[model samples]
Target: MNNIVVKEDVNLPALPNTVLPAISELTAALGIPRDALASHEEIEYAWRDLPRELREIPSELRGELIARMCVAVSVGLFDGAMNYIWNAAILQLRQKIRNFSLAVVAQIQQNDFEEKHLRDLQDSRLLGLCLKLNIIDEDGFFFLDQCREVRNNFSAAHPTMGTVNDREFTTFLNRCVRYALADSSSPKGVEISAFISAIKGARFIDNQRQIWVQRLTSTHDAQRQLLVNMAHAVYCDSATAEPARLNAIDLCNGLSTAFTSSIKADLINTHCEYIAKGLEEKHTASLQFFERLGLLGLLDESEQHVIFSRAINRLWDVHNGMNNFHNEPPFAERLLELSHQGAVPETIQDSFVQTIVCCRIGNGYGVSNAAVCYYDELIKGFSPREVTDLILAAKDRTSNLGRRIAGVGSCKRNFKTVLNLIDTASVPNLVRADYDNFVR
Candidate 1:
């Protein structure tokens, strides 16, 4: 009998910079013999036969994506390359949409997107946004979603043991480039208005409704804004008959709900910021926009969570440094209204209470009457137990700001008022005693 042992070479220093720790950690854990990591020259030679598919992309984005893809290919980083491939498509779509809406593009260009939106978006979300805007067809969106799944399961960004060979990688790379660079057929604005007007008064009977749905499903993204515009009118137009308005709202929701969940969530999330910014600019109608959305249940839990979180944080932003607590009450009230509408989840009720308590009511500013009123409204959303925990937690904190807001000594009157708002019967005697002792 003869025995042969073969040792595999491990090229420690040749690994690509894009390789995630999870991948390297897993490789080490498995004790698998590593092949010599491909060098830049080797990778470039391998990709030499791959055609330049970025010609259709805009110049600004084309150069950046080409650079990213070249580096990824040069490093033999299949996952990063795929990631960049999908990103290139989304970038082109967003750029096209920006061109379509110059004003929005200007706002983004002026850095308003930073204040109003979360900049680092995931590929699913970016593709979903494109879908909502009619920049990509449903087939394209779903196919890209599949590509995103591949990235998530095999890319350097996550911990995955999956591997991609040259054939599979090149095939997907070309497919992504095609999908991203393909031209979308946006419906003319006139077409969208006619469709909205035709559907607004028509009874949504099976035949009529089905025709409208089919047309809506086929309508391009640029034209879909008219549907939103019409829906906004239905809610905001006081002259609209009650029954007619509700019919129009229902019709609009039916069309929107037809989209996949990711697309639907994207539409809702984007609209939320748009509406909030509108409100900031003193567009009171934006509140009605949100109320109408709430009435239709178009806002899912996650969308509502984003709305609530943003609105609450804005309270501090609007008031914190400027002493402009005027907006705090309204936002706080809006947060409560959403909670009462079952928008905020029960699991998050305690966290909301914690957020309220965690607010740094500086000693110099003290707790404003608006702050007191804000929490008075906010605490109504929580259970007696949760509210009690919040009060107790506030009292236990050792900081001057905490002690000040907790109503220690000179602030006892404020603390007593907060306690009175809750049912003291459920509160521990110690909490009641502290309030009583401070008052006496």
Candidate 2:
């Protein structure tokens, strides 16, 4: 299925009377339950069908044919009225004999997929529609095949931004899908959630961040709320040590950039259920933002304990950090950091374990915390120089996994951690060796 289809036309169809009710009825028939704000105009605009001659066609007359075909496909998807309009449109197209180009017909037939995946990640409507049309096998594997790219794309995220919020995002997404199919509600929510879900599946590391930035910059409150949920979800779901750490960092960084004083913390606390979880880090991205404002002192003694306690549990493997820690030294180091940072106890370790697992089988994301662990083990088999070279090589590879490897404030924090880790006798001797080499 071509995710990318560009229409090349030289003519326009005489504009048909804009029939909005017919469009909505047809959308209903197509199994779309709801749309936040989809209307006749939007339908016509987004359909990718040749409009009733937005421009005049030359001798080719392709515009008239495509316009007719658009009505026909709409009728077909919508059924009763769709059948009527489609039959009439086909007749009209036939009457316009000069327009019966085989190439144009083929293109129209292929493009019967105007409302494809709509997720905007990989133009997968072709795959989904082909499966539905019986042009392609709709066997057990079809859904699997259709979303292979999407799955692959999502799998690339680090587990620390575990699929938790992604799962919730998916749930909300499914709710929107239900609305698109059966709810007959506004298209607004559906569009927003779809945007978030698709953005989560995008190739860029900072796509979600950009969305939040856009939400903040835009005057639209709904878009702002949608992005807020998404940002929170990223923080709430992550499983890997580093990405999760950075998500927590980014939330604070983002908050600092946007809000001030207790208002910032108030906003985070008000909307984010995971705010307590995030603050547990103690080492937040906006420590300066809070510190300079004196909001830092608002954190009480117990709050600090819970945060550090949870980190300690994630760091449990680190207590035995000397010899066997080398088996998963990075894990131990990360755990140690998390532990030292503080969190509640390790009472829910089983539930937390799944958050760290890879979403799909054999999915390898190099910039992921998982990849860091994988590399740590792989480097054990190499010479120190080779390991140093590999680390340098990786520096140029893989995106930030939803968090920059270094940020202005976060970099200084990481530097502090590196210094501490290097000085700490409990860590592997090779850790300091790697750090010294990394800076050089």
Candidate 3:
């Protein structure tokens, strides 16, 4: 048999004037009160609303079920019309599940989801499953669940508890079409098992990584966020293989642009959990995770201070060690990157300024040539407060920079070069005298 298709331009015919009166007369002849049937005014109002609401549904979706709904509405059977539209909505949701792949559903639910399970699910459970699988979003779930309740209590599919007025029926139709039938291209849910497996397996090549990233971007925001947390957890796991760790990092990096405040908060809370538990390894890994994602600015000032202090102290140690010139570039470059991330925490500003100055002014042997550029850039970018600290360091008498600048040699001349790199405008008024004296 050939299927009949409905066109979008096909208008639904209005109920004839005689229909409501005939229904009332027929009820009276059957020894039933006319009040049992809809009033003429109610039928008129409902018939007037049908055509406008039906226009919102797409042409492809206006199939036989929609035709049946129009026919029911034409006879003033508002309950039957509601039942028809509700059935159409449920069928569309079911088709979406089928297209989303039952195998993926089974993987996500962590159980076997065969055709039988899908077929046997009640309307409430079906809506719930769609929500869990991200076939519908939170708002869709909310309004559709209310539609289900209306269908259960007032639609003709069951014995009616109460009658719905023209306004209520129109609202029901609008919601069904707006939330369920209208959105035909809802995102398919990510299969959690497969995603975790991919991350835990061999390292992803460029194309493979791009494919996964696209899948993540196309999926719903909730799933993207959950996957982000999972990737972070995988990266921090002590026993995870190197390839897996890199895979997790790549996934998180890909989705980093979409991170909401909630996602960031969850990550910070997890990081704090590791710290509270005294899990040094995981804490360190979490710090690296934030740094690699360029999200260190999200951390609090005290945390930033600790991070900068450790990095500065490490660089200072390497500068004072043997073969300092050969070892200093990487450390200097790393500190430069960290400084680029955000303002230096006020607590670390003094040490931060002193270290850069001491490094720029070489020891007796001379500065690390490879690390000089990084030092110059850092000095040029210093805040006015940091410039104040720099001048103070040269006059402190006990500090290395103070003692070196007290004498006349390459060390003193390099300090002069460091002063030249600073922007003169950034010099605070209180320290202008000291800065000018150092320059002279």
Candidate 4:
């Protein structure tokens, strides 16, 4: 037997006005009876027959699927109608899955699946997976699986094992739309994603902020989690504008305290890592934000350790400025002071020590000397063993000190005296190298 093909532009032969076409003849030859072939406009009328609440589903949500389902329903092809309804349900499930895990979406886009694995995930398994992920509750899951069974048993895509009458098909279609396809019945719930994007891209005035804050807080935690997740994504997005980033930070601050303490700590950790890699503008904005958060007591000591260490590791870059700016900011000195106020993580201790040595031995008399006052405060944070490692990295980096080597000899002498004098018991015996050649 030859395979049947459904072409996009199908033209049916028109009979004379007096001719009567049998339903069986028309179906066998044209795949649908003349009376069953409804125009797209007529199918739209059938869509209106759905209840107002079911009709309220966003057209953007599986619009094509709904249109196909409507056309199938209009034509009295009840089996095909069930198949289209099942397809619509799957569309919603796939969308929710993408929003849940971007990595899974990437895998799908890359076609990173075995053929057997792909085959095993039938429509029933798709609904079951969504159920396990809490995308749909148990009742909805079981109801959808029943709908899938209907499609499999009687739909045109499968061999004709049974049939559903027109009234039965319409009721099944309505159930699918109401329970499985629509985003929500409540209007405010539908607006949460838009609200998140709005807060990120634009700043809100005082009155506007109050209105939105009220709406956001009134929503249950389940809905608010979506807002907070989207906010974090916007905050860390590199393509987000500088002003937008500041706006996102402000918005996240408002929502931060609402989250559990553990969630807030993780949130702070993520943004701190982003700010650490950003340029001077980001550094300034993020630093002030952290200071404000610290004052509010939202930022704990562990979070402070993460933030300050990241900032310290980038101090040299800020002092020299990026490729665009020539004049270095006072960030190096400011960051050096911050390091002393808290415990630096052991992971970053090596980088911190390297930064201090390079800055102290530099030839320039400007920013380099500005770093002198904090040397005592900074070195106290390290131990004797770390200091030994710091000296070695410094000697390797400054082996051929240029014109700066002259001043560096005195700088080294002063630093060693400070280290050896303070905490004399913990300090190792100073092995003095030649000041002109060795220390330089």
Candidate 5:
């Protein structure tokens, strides 16, 4: 998409010529794409010439450049608070972040032990550093987890479901800050792709990643790998590994204690679209990721219940949040597989019942309103004709007292029902496109 680079004139740290040259050298050794370790002479040219180009670039190119920079920084090529910024991540892939942070502290000469602003910034930086080294600080990650869960409850605080493209991600962050500070019992929230995407494209452009998403989708030359990676990571867990079930239970109970305490974000098309592709491609590893974590004793009883409740209470949120509506056919097939296997957690039953309620008669799941999104996405995979048959299947299976069962029949029927009811706008892609993969 012709991603433009941004050159920040901020009084941020600059890499030494030796450091800059090392980028090309390492890249040459590893044979990374578009990489060449800068020579001392090459560093001069890049630092001098690259900065000028970055300054004058148009908005469209900014997203591409910003994304590239994120990769660069992670690899130890680029460093620190550039005039530009990116979406932050908890994905730990680097091994020298601790070392990098030490370097950063010295380079920036940032000092302020008591100021909240600086503390937050440094904490964020430290988090990034820890991730690089794969040194996952359990306490700190839990802290982040707390922030997410607490903040997600604020969705009820919103007037709609899922997020709207309106405020972009500012609403999510602002609320997270408040939730974290207010001390809600809700567990920390998990991030959707938008969260990471926002961090990736936040700085350097006014339109943010909106323009970038468009460019990538519009291109015949777009890297399919990036799209695929984006989809794969979308609903992936944002939690830190807990020691055993006890810790997980603590987290679950901690978050569960606050179930009737939230709101929704307005659902937007772009957000939904990205979410769909990701959820569609969410591999067996991802779903199993949670289940395995649960069985590992890394998840607690409370957490199990909460997870179930969420599954029951927010199946729609599960689908919508994960952007399942735009997902490909394989996603539906995968859902069917998960449902058929005895491996599907009993914990998710409560939520599955909720899904039946939402899609069956448009009513109760003890959750007030059903998370309709889930019902919709699963059903969307089917055609209108198939949907009607599914609806019949759902209606036939309703309990005498009227609770929906969580079985292959129910799942398949519900999937059909959801699709049948979905309006055209609800589906993000008319003719689906392959989610592109990237070097995550």
Candidate 6:
């Protein structure tokens, strides 16, 4: 972070004593006061602070423009020093944008972006682009915008509104160095065109998938959030090819753990839009999107009810079909995953408890051995309200479960096993007596 490098034993010249008087005499001859130029004391104060301020800038950034800035400061031309430092900072910002990929900038803007466009960009607009691309953050943008204003109005770049004193000059230089020149770890921009193409192309293999996931994880949160929205859109598009759809879901699955609150908010907003606009196909796919990401809990209660009820009905249907033992595990496992995401909604708790209890109780033949673990897990996680539903199902003689339990065989024994899965503390007061009697 050293600013100025000087060789050992090299003598540096100081300002001559007669220089100030000569300037004063010339100003008197021109009929203008000597106050137009900075006093010797003001220049001395400014020079004293130069080494300290310049040390904040990185060694690699102390290029030709910086050297010129140093020379200007030594000569007491504070306005010219401001101009040189501002130019160096601007060049660094432009290089950051260029390194971020001008082609990607074009994709995001949805227009042609070239070197000329970058070079010709007004200072204000360049900061705007840098903010949008996440090359600089919000705080950086604010401070740098202030610096740009100073350069335009007070520095040598434009006609002077006022002259800057030593403190003002140091403050401007500090901001430029802190915000743009010394910041080397800003988030890199992703190339939108390449990202979209890779997602829409053939399905990704394991290594390729890992590579893309690493890229998304490495990028700025704004771009990662934008890509998540795009992935949802792609997954929901009916026209998208099967492989592409798979790719989209895979990308989402990989990055699900890294989703920020902003990303989650964007997803919820998009899902709500689909429902409001009556985009049934997209809405259906959107549900699957949430389900695959294990984000079903983020949906409203009514939507969660629909998701659970549909899953429960599908499991029940598979349970009653021919080869029920072989067909039930997958559906049961899926239901287990959904339940893990959040509680079963109050609206669907009755059917959810009954189906799981009934399936676990089994028919006269026996239970689906493969699905027993899933049913056991679901029963073990029942809320107190759901526990009440379970006890009620056992007490209702007209119901299939009660009818089977009342019989004198394996169904009765299986019902006892179901009761064992429930914790004694979970039994509601109204059902405590019935649950104890049933266990006995």
lDDT of each: 0.56, 0.35, 0.87, 0.55, 0.35, 0.88
- Write model 4 residue lDDT over 1-440, tens digit each, in one string: 95553223222233323323333466559776454543334443444454443354655654676667655554546677678777777766665655554343233234553435434567777776566445677887877777777777778878977676655566667667755666532213325445756676566776766666666565434545555655656655566776666666666567656775555665566556665776554444444555544422445565566666666656666544543122222555565556545555566666766665555544344334545556545666567656555545545544422223334665455545544533534444552242223423
* Tens-digit lDDT string for candidate 1 (1-440): 75542322322234355643444455568886433344344454446634444443334445676678666766567777777776666666656555445344333235444312434656677687667656667887877788788878876668866767666677677667666763433322224445556545645666766666566565554445445555555555566665556666555656654545554454455556665665443123434455545532565565455556666667556656465554456656666666665645444545566555444232344655665566776654456567556656566666433466655454444555555666656566656665455334
> Each model's TM-score, in the order given?
0.34, 0.23, 0.83, 0.36, 0.20, 0.85
Task: Compose the digit string of candidate 5's lDDT tens values, residues 234-293.
Answer: 333344222322222232222232222120011122223434577433333343444432
lDDT-wise, the better of 1 and 4 is 1
How many residue pairs clash per model? 1, 45, 0, 1, 57, 0
Q: Mind giving the per-residue lDDT tens digits that candidate 6 earns over 1-440?
A: 85664422323256567765776787889999777877667777777777766776767777899889877877667899999999999999999888877887787788999999999999999999898877888999999999999999999999999999888998998888888887544556778778889999988999999999988887767789999899999999999998999999999999999899999999999999999999999999999999989999899999999899999999999989999999999999999999999999999999999899889999888999999999999999999999999889889998778888887478889999999998999999999999999888
- Regions more than 4 Å wrong, model 2: 1-191, 199-203, 206-215, 218-226, 233-256, 260-300, 313-316, 321-440
Better of 1 and 5 by lDDT: 1
Candidate 4: segments with Cα more than 4 A from true spot = 1-194, 204-220, 254-258, 261-314, 317-330, 333-348, 360-377, 383-385, 391-407, 413-440
Whichever of 5 and 6 has more lDDT, that candidate is 6
Task: Tell me the lDDT of model 1 at 324.
Answer: 56
Q: Where is the poorest 10-residue window by lDDT in model 4?
A: 6-15
Q: What is the C-alpha RMSD of each candidate to the true structure, in Å?
A: 20.9, 24.9, 4.8, 18.7, 24.9, 4.6
Which scores higher on TM-score, 1 or 5? 1
Candidate 4 RMSD computed on C-alpha atoms after optimal superposition onto the true structure: 18.7
Answer with 1 or 6, whichever has the higher TM-score.
Answer: 6
Best by TM-score: 6
lDDT of 2 by residue, 168-225 (tens): 2233223212211111111111234444454444343576766544435432233334
Instruction: Report the Cα lDDT for residue 59, model 3.
Output: 74
- What is the per-residue lDDT of model 3 for residues 356-426, given as tens digits with 9 covering 90 to 100? 88888988679999999999999999999999988888889898788877764888999989999989999
- On a 0 to 1 TM-score scale, where does candidate 1 land against the true structure? 0.34
- Candidate 5 vs candidate 6: the TM-score winner is 6
Give stretches of model 6 more than 4 Å off.
1-56, 185-187
